[model samples]
Target: MAFPFFGDDKSTIARLLSTLPQTGRIEWIGQRPVRREPLVAVLEAELKTDSHMLGDHARPKAGGKRQVTLIQHESLTAVSSFLGLDAPLDPGRLRRNLAVSGLNLLALKNRQIRIGEEVILDITGECHPCSRMEEVLGPGGYNAMRGQGGLTAHIAQGGIIRVGDVVRVLESATA
Candidate 1:
């Protein structure tokens, strides 16, 4: 017999917690193969351990916290409205490396998220919109992206990430 205040049995708790991982789908993949140029959309990308996503223009730094950036596909509508536009914003215009749907990216901050079966990402911080937003999104674009920008993450466990792959929230933030 177990005490009531001791909480669930270990195995039961493990099963429940594992079932709680949030699920989403990768809608698009983009890479800036050349510096200062546009992000080229692709069907797949390679993620390397402790490095930036392969084929991307951004150089990997030792112990870098930002190896990749992602945006929520649903935020385009909100960003469009913020800019007083009738149409949704394009993901490419945002310059994010990944576009995802069905999960709140912000809620994953400081958490460990997994893509597909092997690729794991540690959400480090927000992917703040840069001044380039003004150049690509027109006047007031910088402000329009405030709070609409997505999440930045580093490669926790590297592997291939493909379009249409599932994005799973494997664990909550430790701190």
Candidate 2:
């Protein structure tokens, strides 16, 4: 279904959505070496086409929509403030594979993006917080992470991605 705003002038909306001039930077990278275990921070990692990140425990089936996960760096501060903490929550605590700053991950939903010099990912959907958030972040943790749960993506093109890499939206989903 097409949104009313995107009915006749869809190109305008598409153009606007695709015109993301600001780029994001990878603030942190974490890998889950085991299920139910805390993610370990890494300086870099390898993305395998149609598969999970190398060294990460998750092994999604080929063409899986959740080959990678990403979170907004700013959301950590928001979640912290929501929980009345004086400092931002650690990226690893949230369990996302990547923490990016300066761009809105939500805006990239259903879009393709290139990271660093090689990796390309397709933002697939929202990565909602699980019950484990309560364990990791105490009471109200789940509620606090409702909208800030970050994004799930699939590797469209594989390569090495590292800390400090630039994230640029390659195109709008419609394109």
Candidate 3:
């Protein structure tokens, strides 16, 4: 899909995107992801930090900037299976820098995803993919994670990220 989006010889992709600005740009922030994790609050209270509207209490300050991660809705669906039938993965649990609906997650790599009035995340690299996904998802939870999940990006500018905020992708050279 991205190949069709950036083909130099074909300007149609750009034109299509220009016409469909709102197709995949806006998504309602339903829930936080990590809040579903049992004992996550015990492990770290950063979830309650004022700087973090979701669960980013322990953002790195010495490294230069904090990291942001975004998980796909498909992955979110996968997460639901891991979560108990009684309790769903909280929207706040995933702690996605930007919870999106229409755009392709893979296509946004290395791009700047703008959230809120001042927050900008410099998608640095894939956040450390962990077995915690399996712990939460259970059973083939490990297999469900075979190449489908979330991503990690660094926060270029730090600010409060909350639910109901709009996200904009500031496309870069690679995007």
Candidate 4:
């Protein structure tokens, strides 16, 4: 069933398709109202509704668009670099729920991501830093975090998410 010019080598096509980015790892996990405290070893991302997640105190309305927040280790590093810092910035200071690695989070907008095995989240949009960034990261902090502030998402399915668990892309965003 292959096209004339394109070879019938199905294996090659399969490999090429599989190479698309679809997986990441949870590097750190934190919750608000408990900033700078020890991170939870395991995160239970229980979603009772589309806009609800366990352990999140913000508790936006039932249809909240930002049920959870996630940040990338790379973005943290970029901010630190922007500020002339010697080391990467601590993710806790950003007040995000999950600090993940190996995923281009900005590219995930409108996509569905599965954390661990069952927890599914819908990428809502870029998470812009509030004025608190200056208080947390010192001078020029707010500007440093401008485009590096990670992303916001809503829980689409309930499940437990643990540090070191794999985060997989379930569905990609359509144009």
Compose the digit string of candidate 3's lDDT tens values, residues 7-125.
66547765654442442333433323444433222211122111333443334443332344566655556566654344445434454444456666666665677666666666555
lDDT of each: 0.87, 0.93, 0.50, 0.77
Clashing pairs in 2: none
TM-score between model 4 and native:
0.79
Q: Tens digit of lDDT per residue, candidate 2, span 29-139?
A: 999999989999999999999899998999999989999999999999999999999999999999999999999999998889899999999999999999999999999
Instruction: Say which candidate scores most in lDDT.
Output: 2
Of 1 and 2, the candidate ranking higher by TM-score:
2
Candidate 1: worst-modelled 10 consecutive residues by lDDT: 13-22
Q: Tell me the spans in candidate 4 whose CA falls farther than 4 Å from its real position.
A: 1-19, 34-48, 172-175
Backbone clash pairs for candidate 4 read: none
Q: Write down the TM-score for model 2.
A: 0.92
lDDT of 4 by residue, 100-170 (tens): 89988887887788888788888888999888888888989999999888898877777778888898877
Clashing pairs in 1: none
- Each prediction's TM-score versus the true structure: 0.85, 0.92, 0.59, 0.79
Stretches of candidate 3 off by over 4 Å are 1-57, 61-66, 78-98
Residues 1-175 of candidate 1 have per-residue lDDT tens digits of: 8754357588766555445456999999999999888889999999899898888989779678888999999988988898899999878889999999988888788778889999999989999999999999999999999998999888878999999999988755534
Candidate 1: residue 31 Cα off by (Å): 0.1
lDDT of 2 at 170: 84
